[model samples]
Every structure is written in structure tokens, then in C-alpha cells.
Target: MAAPLTLLLIVAVTIRAALYRSSLVDIISERVEVVSPLTAWKRVVEGLALLDLGVSPYAGDVFHETPLIIYLFHFVIDYAEITFMLADVITAVALYMSAQEYNKQVFRKQRFALEADRYPMDCIELIRSPKEMYYIPLKVAMFYLLNPFTILSCVAKATCGLNNAVISLFILATIKGNVLLSAIFLSLATYQSIYPLTLCASALLYLMQRQYIPVNPRRASFWWFVAQYAFMYLGSLFVIVGLSFFLLGSWDFLPSVYGFMEHPVFLIFMQLAVISIFKSYPTVGDIALYMAFLPLWNHLHRFLRNIFLVSCVLLSCSALFPVLWHLWIYAGSANSNFYYAITLLFNVAQILLVSDYFYAFLRREHHLTYGLYLKRKDGSEATLVLK
Candidate 1:
């Protein structure tokens, strides 16, 4: 795994380095789908210039990144390309570790269930084998590192890579049962973009589950654990916010950075796609994070209804985005409506993809619990319908 991961990193780095030096770097950086205003390298450069001139980066409406980001680039501006590449590497590695840890937990639970004879005899076919689970983490890393969206985001130097790294670290920490580190990374992620704040509840729920704490409202232990995690998360967030203010000596960033994104409902896996579509300024980097998780749910493929159709739609949209943008902005043959129509279709496709996966996952769980062939009380075949 180490050798393969290292080779993948090398290949990923080589590709990014090549693109960074090519004529397409500028074009890639300017693409609206690849680099949004909030995460754009160009705006980061502008912010760095403002900071160098003793002016606030947020004084103008151009830069909306957090203060820590501006200062981070201030020191490493010369190696911006390397920094973005490193961020992508960190994200992939973290996700790999996370997937590995999660697989272990799942296998452990399945073993326990088997020992207890909790699953139906007819559902034996649904049991996962070690061989099938072994390559999931590696595939997860490969998916992320080799994903065209991830590659483009890295080449464009989008800070969305940094955000993904933070979120990935948060996930790794959560799965590894390090409460404090999870809270810290979660805070950092939320601080980077308000959208990640929704992950707090999911992380808390996962941590509680790992600790064998039931979610009964009457349990003092449950409440205590919740309070403890909340305090750590909020405290870490406060410290990060305070440090930002101390660095800049003002609260100007509050409105400029945190105020830019909308808050959505908490559906951990689906939230990433929602953010990518609904954020004030979205980019391909945001979509890469969610798409990387698809492999983790590969077992649900047999139950998925629209996987092929959704895949076709997503691929078509990805290719047409540039063509439509070129027509609208450069060729002047198409209008904003033309490009926006594609954007709407792209988002709808993503929503359908996420929804289909969610349904498939639920169906798999149902089958695993009740047996593959469900029957009614009268011995007639039964069907499950989602409202």
C-alpha cells in the first residue's frame, strides 16, 4: 500500500507540475467551474499584494478567503504550486487512512453480527469478504488523486484543496477516535468555509457510536459526551477565530469570509455535493471531495437505479462546461442562459447521483437485515417503496 500510494503521489505530482508549467495553467485557473471567486488563486494573489502593502485583504470585495490563508500564502507564495499539490496529497492520504479505519470498523461490526446470528440465513450472500474490502482504501486514494477535478483544482492552486485536506483530516481523526484532533480539524475546516460546520453533528454522532454510547435522551453519559465534544469543537473554533482577529486586528473577515456561504441541512455524504452546487462561488474542487467517496459505497452499485444515466450526464456536463463557457464568453455566439442551462443540468445530475446512491445504500441495509427476498404475511412477494 505504501509503495503504491507513493507511486500514485509521484504520478499525481508529475501531472500537476507539468500542467503548472504549461500554457493551459492560465486557462485552467480562469475556468469558473475549476476555480471559483472564493477559492481562486488570482484573488489570493491580490490579497497577498494588499497584505504586503499594509492594507487589509478584505478591504475590497475581491478577496473572501480566511485571514490564515492570506498569511499562509504570504510566506509560501513562491511555492504556491507545491503547496496546492501538497494539500491534494494530504487529502488523498487522509481519505485513504479514513477509508481503511472505517472498513475495519465495518468488518468488526459485521463479524459481531455474524457471531450473534443477527443477520438472516438467506442474507449470507450479502456478507462482504476480506479480499473485496482490502483494496477499497487504495482505490479511494487513487480515485481522489487521479480524479480530473482534483488534478485541475491542484493545478489552478484553488484553496478548495486546502479545505478538502482539512475536512479529510477531520474525517480521519473522527474515525481514528481522536476526539480532540477531530474537533480541531473540524474547526479549521469550518473556519475555512462555513459549509463544513454541518459536519460537526455527523462527527459527534460517529464518535458517540464508536464509544458505544447510545443516543437515548435520558442517558446522562450521552449528554455528557455531547457537551464535551461540543465544548471542544466550539472552543477550538473560537480560538481559531480569535487568532485570526489577533493577526489582522479587526473583524472585517467575519462578513467577508464566513458570511459568504449558506448553511444547509446535515446529510454528511450528500452535504459535499450540496455545497459544491449551492455555495456562493462553487468549483470543481468541491465536487472532487464527494466523488471520491463514491468508491466507499461500491457495494451499493447492484441496487443503484440511475448510476449509468447519472454517469453519462456528469461526463457530458464536465466536457460541455468548457465548450459552453468558451461560446458564451469568447465566441459570443451563446448567452449566459445557454451556459446556465448546462450548469443547471449539471447540478441536477449531481443531485440525482447522490440521491440514487442514498437510496441504494438504504436498500442494501434493508436487504442485509430482512433477507434478500422479502415476503409479505400472506406469502406474496413484497416490495419496498421510498416516499
Candidate 2:
């Protein structure tokens, strides 16, 4: 696994480095789909220049990145390419470890359920085996590193890659059941982008699940855990924000950096997808984050509806994005409507894909609980329908 991951990292780095040195760097950086207003490297450079001139980076409308990020690149602005590349590597490695730990927990829970004869006998085929799960971590790592979206973002030096790295670290920490690290990383991610704040509930739920804390109002232990986790998360966020304010000697970032879209949390996948699709200035890097998790649900393929159609739609839209952009911007033959149509279609395809997976997962859980073949009281076959 290490050897394969090493080779993949080297290959990913080579591709990014080549693109960084090539003439396409400017072209790639200027792409609307690859670099948004908030995460563009050029804006970061502009902000750095302002800081050097003893002016607040947020004084202008150009730079929207958080204070900590600007400070981070303040020192590493010369090696911006390496910084982006390193962020991608860190994200891939964190996701790899997270997948491994999550798989183990899933297998453990399945073993307990099987021992207790909790699952229906007809659900035997749905059980995941170690052989099938063996390479999932490597696959996850490969998905992140080899993903074209990830590569494009890295080459563009978009701060979205850095946000992805922080979110990945939060996921890794939560899966590993480290209470403090999970809170801290979650805070860091939330600080970077306000959308990540939705992850707080999910993380707390996951930690409570791991610790066997029942979600009952009567359980003192549950409330204690919730309070403790909230305190840590809020405390860390306060500290990070304070550090940023102290570094800049102003409160300008409170609005420029932290003021953005608010999202509701349903599941982690849906939350991520919503953020990517509905954020103020979305980019391909945002989409890449959620797409990496799709492989983890491959087991639900049998229950999925519209997988093929949705996949085709997504692929076609991804390919047409640049062509449509060129037509709208450069050729002037087409208009923003033409490009926006594709963008709308692309987002609709994403929504359909997410909805299909969510349905499939629920349906699989239903089958595992009841018999695969459901029957009514009259011994007639029953069909489940969404109301």
C-alpha cells in the first residue's frame, strides 16, 4: 500500500509540477470553473502585496481568503506551487487513513450484529467481506490524487485544496475517535470556510456513536459528552479567530472571510454536495471533495436508480464546461445563458446523483432490517413507495 501510494503521490506531483511550469498555468488559473473569486491564487498574491504595503488585505473586494491562510502564504508565497502540492498530498493521505479506520469500524459493527442474529437471513448477500474491503483505502487515495479536478485545483494553487486538506484531517480525526483533535481540526476547517460549520453536528454524532452514548435527553452522559465537545469546538474556533484578529490588528475578516452561505446538515455526503453546489463562488475543487466519497457507497449500486443516466450526464457536463465557457467568453457567438445552461444541468446531475445514493443506502438498510422480499398481512407481495 505504501509503495503504491508513494508512486501515486510522485505521479500526482509530477503532473502538477509540469502544469505549474507550462504555459497553461495562466490559462488554468483564469478558468472560472477551476478558480473562484474566494480561492484564486492570484487574489492571494494581491492580498499579500497589500499586506506588504501595510494595508489590510480585506480593504479591497478582491481577497476573500481567511486571515490565517494569508499569513500562511505570507511566508511561503515564493513556494506557492509546493504549498498547494503538499496540501493535496496531505488530503490524499488523510482520506486514505480515514477510509481504513471507517472500514474497520464498519466490519466490527457488522460482526456484532451477525453474532447477535440481528440481520435478516435473506440479507446475507449484502454483507461486506474483508477481501472486498481490502483495497478501499488505496482506492480512496487514488481517487483523490488522480482525480482531474484535484489536479487542476492544485496547479491553479486554489485555496480550496487547503480547505480540503483541513476537512480531510477533521474526517481522519473523527474516524480515529480523537475527541480534541477532531474538534480542533473541525474548527480549523470551519475557520477556513464557513460552510464546514455544518460538519460540527455530524462529527459530534459520530463521536457519540463511537462512545456508545445514547441520544436520550435523560442520559446525563450524553449531555456531558455534547457539552464537552461543543465547548472544545467553540473554544478552538474562538481561539483561531482571535489569533487572526490579533495578527491583523483589526476585525475586517469577520465579514469578508467568515460571511458566506449557511447550509443545513442532513448527512455528510449531502452536506458536502450542497456546499459545493450552492456556495457563493463554487469551483471544481469543491466538487472533487464529495465525488471522492462516491466509491465508498459502491455496495449500494444494486439498489440505486438512475446511476447510469446520472453518470453520463455528469461526464458530458464536465466535458462541455470549458467549451461552453470559451464560446460564451471568447467567441461571443454564445452568451452567459449558454454556459449557465450547462452549469445548471451539471448541478442538477449532481443533485440527482446524491439523491439516488441516499435512496439506495436507505433501501439497503430497509432490506437488512426486514426481509429482502417484503410481504403484507395477506401474504401478498408488498412494494415500498416514497410518499
Candidate 3:
């Protein structure tokens, strides 16, 4: 049922303008401008020359910071159509895999595990009747149908390199008890994009819960917790060091992470993380999505993943509108703000839209409650009167 929508998302991203040749050089130029300010002017001048080349010398310029794998797009991804479509296909696969995991947790494990004897995790769970086991599928089916945020965030990473869908899949694999594979995926994810290093969050969480592996003979949660955070902090420190070596220019700004903490958006991003955890808590999939979005934070330690993954790009775009407009008005870049505002608006729309899907899951639960109450035979119960 979800397969077709997954395909549609891939198709849409492949056609977006950002994937085309015309914009590739410019995107690289922006990065170069940020990292190598000295070369910014020279690169811009040379960048302009690409416009009229005979064989188009500039068409195949190596992206100094990007891997050859991503650079493969230069030679092959000719049309905007091909780019979006390919992105969609990649995203569709990643998203479905994520959804499969979610299904296992929410439907197979948690839903099945509960019984009248087991105290409920929340109030609704305690109060509700047996509901007949068959309804679990109906509920899960409804969630997959409505979970926009889950779909978009999964999709966005695949399309835009907004985050590493590949690495995310790897992290999910680890949480699913594939530790050796997780290690390999983790290394590859780091190599692919520096930001996925924050996947430490999920790694730590998994290790704490006894799901992560070291093949330890002793099963002490304390030692496991220590080892997990020890690795998390250690991995984080080294990943930063590695990025500093590779990105070289970012070395200059590393101090800022420890310095001023004045930005309001910083708090907002943190709040979003906190809120998301409270709302759905972290499944390995949810954690991956959160880690992916972390890089989009307005900070240096940001993850390589972002909400613009092939899935979320469109939905995020819708939310970006007011956010960027306010930024444009403040930055006073009235002349150049139009495009920037448009880009941001789209990103925001996509995120909120995706989130709406999760909230819809909760709504489905609410609807169930509402339905059961409506079917109550007692006349007073229908009037919202005390039982």
C-alpha cells in the first residue's frame, strides 16, 4: 500500500532543480566560498567561464570536498528529471525500510506484548478494552497511511544528501541487532558525510537498553552505559577531528561550539528534539531521523543529514515560508531574500507536514477512544457525564 507513495516521492525529487547540472557548480561554489574565502573570487570568475565553454571544461570539475561516488552524478545526471527521479527511488527504499522497523516495534512487539495484566505505558493504554487483536493492523495501517513526517524525512535524506540515507539505514540495522553491520555502516556513513557521526545518540541509547552488542560475558547495564557514552564522546571527538582535517577550513570555527550560546534558534532546535522525543520517543528509526536533522541546526556540529531528504523537501518547503520571510525582513536582504525565503519556506512546510502524520497516529488512537465512547449504550455516558 505504501509502495506507490514511496515511488511518487522518488519521482518528484528526481525532477527538482537542485539536482541538475546548472545548479551543481553554484552549490559547490557556495561551499568553496564559505571554506576558501581566498579562492572565492577566482572560483566565481572561473565558474562564470563554464557558461560558454566549447566542450564544457567546467562541466566535470572534481568536487574537492565531495566524494567520487556523489561526483558520479556529474557525468550521468544530465537532466533535472533524472536527478529527482533517482533521488526518489533511493529515498523510497530507505523510507520503506524505516517503516518496516516502525511496524515491528509499534505493531508486532509493543502492541502484542500488552495485556490486561501488564500495566499500561500511558493512560489510554490502561483504560482501553482488549480492542480485539485484529484492530492493531487496522491502527498500524492507518498510521502508515497518514504519517507524513516519517515519509518525508526518510525520503528527503536520500534525494538531497540532505542527510545520508545510507548511513541512516546502517544505524537502523545496528539497532535491529546488526552490530557488526552497524559498525561498517557507521564508518561508511562518516566517510560519506561528516555529520552522521552524531549517530552516537542512537548508539548510546541502544547500548543502554541492552540492544547494542559487544558480545560481553558480563551483562552489567552500568558498564554498558559507561562504554556506550565513552564511545559516543570518543567517536564524536574524533569525528570532529577528522572533519577538521578533511574540511580544514572548519577548523577555524570549532571554538564557536564551546563559546557563545546566544542564538534563539539554537534553543528552538533543541526544543524540537526534546519535543519529538516526548511525542513519539525514539525508535531507532526516529533517532536516525533526528540525527539526520541535527546537521541542519544553525551550528558547526550540525549533522550531514537534513530534513530536505528527498521525502521532506517538499513538505519542509511549505513550512519554510513564514520562517524565511521573517528572516528576510530581519536580514534586510530584500533584494536577494526572495529565493532564500522560498527555499526555507519549502523546508518548513515539509517538516511540519511530515510531523502532522505522526500526530495523526495519535489522532487515530484518539478516534478509537472517541468511537468506543460513542458506542456506549448508557444514556448518561453519551452526555460526557461522570460514570
Candidate 4:
């Protein structure tokens, strides 16, 4: 396990180091497809320069990164390239560990279910085999490390990589049932970018299940768990925010860092729909992160309906994003509307893909609980309707 992961780390680092030394680093850093207003390395440098000159980084519109990142890079500016590469490695390693732990828990549950005959008799083929599950963790690490989106983000020194690293660590902590660690990392993520606050749902869900608590609103145990986690999460967030205020001596960052003015309600919902909904690289990295789980869900292939169509739409949007950006920014033949239209389509594709997976997972669970074949009142075969 360590050998392959070490090799993967070496490969990823080599690629990043080479790109950092090459001439493409500057070009890649400036490309809209690779960096956004909040995560661009250029903005961080500008912010650092401002901080050095005894001015607020956020005083001008050029720097929108959080105060923490600015302070972090304040000292490590010399090793900025190395720091980004290390962040990618940390994210990959954290994800690998989390995936391995999750797979073991899944197999344990499946084994218990089998022993208790909890599965439907006709659903024998849906049972996962050890042979098929053995390599999933390694594949997950590979998918994240070799993913072009992650590579680009790292090479461009996008601070999104650091956010991703924190999120990956949060996922790992949650899976390991470390409530304090999970809440801390979750708060850190939320502080970095408000979008991760929506991930509280998934994290709470995973934590509740790990503790064997039923997810019923009327149940005391469920509510207790929810309140406990919520308290920790919210408390940490408040502390972090208060610290940021004290450090900066102003609240100007609230609107800029959180995008409080523009689309406040819609921004939260939009970010919730696509957790990785950065302008470009972040979304792809999010897609790749989930893509690692597809093999674990191979049993769900038979249950999915629009897998192919959803995949094609996502692929087309990904391919078109760069072309549209080029035309709008360089060729001068297209406008922001054209580029934004593709961005909308891209996010729509992501939503549809995630929805398909949600459906497939639920349908598979249904088959496992009930019989795969459902009978109507008239003794005829019944089919599930998503709509």
C-alpha cells in the first residue's frame, strides 16, 4: 500500500516540479480555466504585496482570498510552489486512507447482512466480492493524483488545492469517527470558502450512521447527535470568523470573501448543488474525486438509466469550457454570455450526473431491502418511476 502510494506521490510531485520550472507556469496561472478570483496565485501574490506594505489586501478588488491564506503565504511565499504540490499530495493521501476505511466498513456491513440473510434472495448477483473491492483504494488515489484537473490546480498554485486538502482531511476524519477533528476541519473549510458549509448534511449523515443513530427527526438520539455536531461545527466557525475579524480589524472581508452582496441565497444553493463549483478547475477536481467511487458502485450500473447521456453531456461541457474561454478572452469573437452559457451547461451536467448517482444508489438499496422485482396489486410486474 505504501509503495504504490509513494510511487504515485513521486510521480505527481515530479510532474508538478517540472511544470513549476517550465515557462507554462505563468500562462497556466493566468488562464481562467485553471484559476478563479479567489484561488488564483496571482491574487495571492498581490495580496501578499499589499500586506507587506501595511495596507489591506482586500482594500482593492484585486485580492479576494481569505485572510488566513494571505497570512500563510506571507511567510512561505518563497516555497509557494512546493506548498501547492504538498497540498495535492496531502489531499491524495487523505482520500486514499478514507477510501480504504470506507471500503472496509462497507465490506463488514455486507458480511453481516449476508450472515443475517438481510438481502433479497434474488439479489445474489449484487453482492460485492473481495476480488473486485481489493484495488478500489489504490484506484482512488491514482484517480485523484493523476487527474488533470488536480494537476492543473497544483501547477497553477491555485489555493483551491489547499481547500481541497482541508476538505479531504475532513472527509477522512469524519469517516474515522473523530467528531472533534471533523468539526474543526469542516469549520476550517467553511472559513476558507463558505460553500463547504453545505457539506454539513453529508458529514452529519455519515457520522450518524457510524454511531448507529437512526436519522429520524422525532427521535431523541438523532436530534442529540445533530445538535452536538451542529454545536461543534457552528462554534468552530464562529471562533474562526471572530479570529479573522480581530486579525484584520474590519468586516470588509465579509462581502468579498463570502460574496455576501452578489446572489447571497442563490450562491449557497448553487454551491450546495455543486460542491466544487469553482469557475473551472475546482469543478473538475470534484468530479474526479467522485469518479473514484464509480467502481465501488459498479453494482449500480444495472440500475442507472441515463448514465451514458449524462456522461456525454458532462464530457461535452468540459471540452467546450476552454474553447469558449479562448474565444471570449482571446479571439474576441464571443462574449461573456457565450462563455457563461457553457458554464451553466457544465454545472447542469454536473447536477444531472450527481442526481443519477443518487438515484442509482437509492434504487440499489431498495433492491437489497425488498425484492428486485416488485409486484403490483394486480399481480403484474411494477417498475420504479423517478419522476
Residue-wise C-alpha lDDT for candidate 1, range 168-228, written one tens digit per residue: 9998898888999999998899788876776665676667661111222110122223334
Instruction: Give candidate 2's error at residue 5 in angstroms.
Output: 1.7
| Predicted candidate 2 versus true structure: per-residue lDDT over 290-326, tens digit per residue | 8887777778889988999998998898888889777
RMSD of 3: 16.2
Give the range where candidate 3 is weakest over 10 consecutive residues by summed lDDT. Answer: 210-219
Cα lDDT for residue 197, model 3? 53
Candidate 1 residue runs with Cα over 4 Å from true position: 210-267, 376-387
Indicate the TM-score of model 4: 0.77
Candidate 4 clash pair list: none
RMSD of 1: 12.8
Q: Write the per-residue lDDT of candidate 4 for residues 217-304, one digit (tens) a residue.
A: 2101222233446647555444534443343233223335433332122222233334443321243444555555555556668878
Model 3 compared with the native: what TM-score? 0.40
Off by over 4 Å in 3: 2-64, 69-71, 74-84, 120-122, 125-159, 207-387
- Candidate 3, residues 1-387: lDDT per residue as tens digits? 455554545444443433343544444333310113111223323433443354343354422223333344445544434443443345335544543453454444344445533332333432323332323333332233234343332222222232334654564565465677767777776564444454444444443441121212111122223344565745544453444344433322322442212222222223233322322111212323443333222122112233345346654544554345445446665532453445434334444533443343334445433543443466344445576
